[model samples]
Target: SVNSIRRTSPTGGTSGLCFKKLNITTSSYRIIINRLDRKVTVNYRPARLPFSRHSLYVEDTGSMYLIHTPGGVSMQWYHSTGIMVLQYITRYNASVPTRGLCGCCDGNPEDDLKLPNGTVVREVGDMMLFLQAWRVHTTDETEHTRRVGDNCTTGDCSTCLSMLRQRAFTPCHSKVPPEQFCDIMWAGDLHYKDHQCDFLAAYVAVCYTHQVCISWRRHNFCPLRCPPGKEYQPCVSTCTSRTCLNREYYEETTCSFIREECVCRSGTILHRADSPYCVTEDRCVCTDNEGNPRAPGEVWNGSARSCCLYKCMENGSVVAVEPDCNSVPTPLCEREGEYVLDVLEEGACCPKKICECNMTICDSEAPPCDNGNRLVIGYSALSCCPEYRCECDPMACPPVSAPDCREDQFLVEVRGQKSCCYSYL
Candidate 1:
């Protein structure tokens, strides 16, 4: 849905969008459209700016490509027509089938209206009731909602019938009915020619994939204006770069989809997908790792494990050197007498954020030994400081001897002291 689907702002128009699948809101994203300049902004997930097809690991936010497995799903959004295309790039598997707004994608349309609890709506009259289940309840404030018997008529689009039924579209008439497409374009936005053209272009693109080319645009109606040196084509590759970041060359035969786009003319090329202007091969620009176009004298070192910081040179090449630990800044820690060093990864030359103890910090001073007892110093896991204990030492005892032993009789000790012996019996 294009408006707020969150509970806090049902009609507040705050959140960008919410996609619900089987009674579950997949993700919440906000889209801000600038009325003054007709620009669009997406906040928070995937990307804020325009981007080409990329792996969607987060599965959160607006029209985007998503793939859990290899070639699972591909989504494309044409902002001009407000059309979003979700396709299954992966081969259909009997073990894993999708069931939702797209229907049970198992080659059957009968079970397409199955509810979240696995109940199918079998009655034709209940189709409206089934559709109401997926209603998000967002309406354009600029227009009035038409009731069943209201005299709400969209302008006269009777003139579009002949064009839709033209001989050029005969091959695609059965697959895509002309009356349906014509009426939808009129009902959607009758006054806006671009909207009508955008609406028609969708059907034309579908026909092109079926090996039919549509020449529906008129010279004065929705005529496409391309950049200088570029021409509009009925069919082009879907693997084209949308942003100025990626600069890889692709084989035209390996395109995933054949659609319409503006292509550069001969002798001119785009440095990256998002380049606004066409230039000669030598005049192409360069981009950094973050998808930002960079000029000469800029530096980039966005790679995590790389130990070198690169500088963009005038020749369009980034120069780098394998810097040692001296190039990287050392971290400052609290207190004195502590040191810091890098605990690098197995094959990485860069430093990690781990800290190790270089010196032991003891707490209290040890007391003097007394009574032939010695103080023992030991370490324990509970603390980094040394622990003190008192224990008896045999060598630390006072010297003991008898004064004299009389004849055969041994000397008898007075009291507990051995040195107190005076006379023996």
Candidate 2:
């Protein structure tokens, strides 16, 4: 009965006998043959309606929900799908260990793989890869190329390779060894792009040999050791079989090296040890060498060489006499007076070179006497005028008068004419 449950259409009238007689004496309900013969129709219908049509009449009044909500369908789907895509696109198929296992599975363990000279390949590889990647990703192509070149040449890769090669050839290995070779290779590689490798190479050469070679094509000579103190002397000597001009030379002297300053010979000047060249001189005289009689302007040639006459001074004392102006001279002052005065006899004084008169004799002669008589007073003559009455002052004397022949008057020939003049008038 439950399985057969169904809804049926109502009878033809609104109040049919079946519906109205339900409360009238309530005859036993039964399907009678008489009702069947009266032409009664039966209708059956489904209890539940179809899903699409059933909800059409119902109002969807629930609160509206967003597709992008947190933990929503879209979010969950995206998260799951993204993870799966990433896994699919990965290069290495094997799962990488996150815990204790080593990253590299190759027999040449990253840590253990080293160059012949113990240069680590892993480090070099890493550097190379990093530089390549950076260059590829960067916008600046030239700069990126330069960077790549620098890393490749001077980086660990080149260094490791060089070191390995150096170690393999024991006999031909550099005295500096493979490590130094690696360093040099790296330096060269790094600086090569900039054309700075030459400088680096020079530096390396100097380090290995402890010497430097300089070239001056214009100069004909190269000096060996410098003079005693003049170490920066210009290169004047020929370069043939010469030592470096800056080289040090040992000398024996009677004076203690600790107490006395080192001096150069007559033909030489003191070239300091720190300078690059020795001051050129005829000869270097030793302290123990005897003092020769060097004239005012004479220079001391090396003992082996002849002493040459440099220049002569007519009046000046030669302070120093050497090959050139740089030589130290023995000062020679004229011994004219007891006092020794420094007179610039050779050089110009007041725009000209002239002998200066002796100070004592300057203006010594008295001006010519205007009277022209031999009555000039000698230096020893006694003073005729009193101290208060100077010779230059007006003198009190008898007034000149015409000759007058009086009883007490004395007439005498005055000057060239014979005239009677009053005396003491």
Candidate 3:
């Protein structure tokens, strides 16, 4: 829904990534985001393709789908479209009523702009009023130049047209409109020219979705050069019909599913998924997990951490990474504590968090009560330091009244006041 989630760094830097999160009218699927580990999951499963280097090429479900468990709801995130097209594959409970920016989803177009107060803005002129009703109050920390949209600009915008003139994408003019896509490139040139390639790539991806294939790439511009003996294609079947590892037999999952990738054209077989190296049965190449090709019969050290030997073979069972150096179980003490994490080879899955109990916190050191205010042991989940602190009856100052706040909000306490424990919005 165009969140504009621009995260200006805590140090006040402008460098940050921004993306829009589209909300769908689905009831069953729940996305869990773990802020601590920066992990995103849907229905307790990974939301991305396994071992994908960029994490952009998700699983090929003939059509990429985010299948949620239990309620049977599923969706897919298109990496190229720059949008989350949530296709509700399952139906919600008939008795249950659903509502949001997408509206009730009960087949009514008039109630799409329904406010939080359950009042729908019927007049189109008052749409701004409806927007103001739902507008977030947070201050914008990102600069206007860093916004993720095209600020329609006027200049020599021949750069986007140049990519169009190339023979690779020359046939896609009538298939997909380039005016809106070119706006991003032209606007970006005036501010930051970095997004030119990105916008073009997204445009190509969107065109591909519409079954309009356009193989656009340049060595000097948005370069995604194919490795030796392999070439990038505008659109190709997602299934690997054959590979260097399997010269004989392989299952063709689907021929309709299409995507953009570097492929072995006509005669040669693919060495690996989009790797620069291509191969035949007589001259084979083994690609490590990181896409580096290893020569045939060459015993080279793979992407192993903490010392381990591995050789590239026909089977693509390879993994190597040293991510999360700080993830090891760390011990805290005046002197160095004992280490218990079992050292293993790289790219291990389902990693367990090695924890060591080193210390405990008990004393909170609560403030002393005033005169005539008897201290009594009390328990309140909302109160801070309640484990050690005691409550005061007949407050030192004056007894305070709890603030009237919304149910979704909690009372905020302030110190040193005549009306003790007074709260504010």
Best candidate, TM-score-wise?
1
The alpha-carbon lDDT assigned to residue 312 of candidate 2 equals: 27
lDDT of 2 by residue, 324-405 (tens): 4333334433323223334333331212222332446323344332211221333212222212211211122335665777
lDDT of 3 by residue, 1-425 (tens): 23345444323443223443422222544454322222345556645422122112223232233323232333344322223333333365343354454456556677777888989988756766676676544333233343333345644456666655567665666766555556654554443344455456666666665677676665556655454676656576554436554466656664332556656667766554323345664445456545555654444454345333455454544434334446555443222222234444464432444433222332434566654344565444433233444454544556557778788998877654432344354
For every candidate structure, what is the RMSD over all alpha carbons to the true structure, in angstroms? 18.7, 48.0, 23.7
Between 1 and 3, whose TM-score is larger?
Answer: 1
lDDT of each: 0.50, 0.26, 0.48
lDDT tens readout by residue for model 1, 43-79: 5333433422233232211112222322254554432
List residue ranges in candidate 2 displaced over 4 A: 1-173, 176-197, 203-270, 275-277, 280-350, 353-425
For model 3 the local lDDT of residue 141 reads 29
Sorted on TM-score, highest at the top, how do the candidates line up? 1, 3, 2
Q: Best lDDT goes to which candidate?
A: 1
Candidate 3 lDDT trough over 10 residues, lowest sum:
49-58
